[model samples]
Target: MTSPEEALQQARATYEEHARTCRQCHFDAVPCPVSKHLLRAYNNARREQMRANSGVR
Candidate 1:
């Protein structure tokens, strides 16, 4: 199983790469469907890491 930190890092990198290439990912504006999915993945990874750090299931 991947560690929470690793998962978060992977998710962040994936999202960042997409945002870098995709024109619809303006930080100030609404994201495209793909961007939205990626953002959700990143956020979920982040939350999982936080939960792990806090010893929460």
Candidate 2:
């Protein structure tokens, strides 16, 4: 029952926390794979939502 916006906010918060605790020297920042993965996931979810909504109309 949770809205997508709420879920995204939760995800963003979690990402922020991870970034804060992330080891810079141990890992790359600008090219972080986590951000790339999350972006793909978000795009997929948005596409699915649009597809479902279009079908409903």
Candidate 3:
């Protein structure tokens, strides 16, 4: 298994890549409230994963 820090780094990298792709394709930055909601959901999930892996309980 990977360390928590490593996992967080990978997640950050993935989020950046996805955001970049969205910017290129949508060209509106946020595009729409619905899309923003989905992006926020993804960000929340990443945060949850980080907390789970950090062993802070």
Clash pairs (backbone) in predicted model 3 = none
Q: Tell me, by lDDT, which candidate is best.
A: 1
lDDT tens digits, residues 1-56, model 2? Answer: 65555555656665666566667512755636776566565665556566666775
Off by over 4 Å in 1: 26-30
**TM-score attained by model 3:** 0.48
Q: For residue 37, give model 1's deviation from the true position in Å.
A: 0.3
Report the error of model 2 at residue 49, Å. 0.3
Ranking by lDDT: 1, 3, 2
Cα-based lDDT at residue 42, candidate 1:
93
Model 1 weakest 10-residue run by lDDT: 22-31
Model 1 C-alpha lDDT per residue in residues 1-57, reported as the tens digit of each score: 999999999999998888887876756455789988988999999999999999999
Candidate 3 local lDDT, 1-57, one digit each (tens) = 865556656666666566667754367665555455555755766676768777555
lDDT of 1: 0.89
- Name the candidate, 1 or 3, with the larger lDDT value: 1
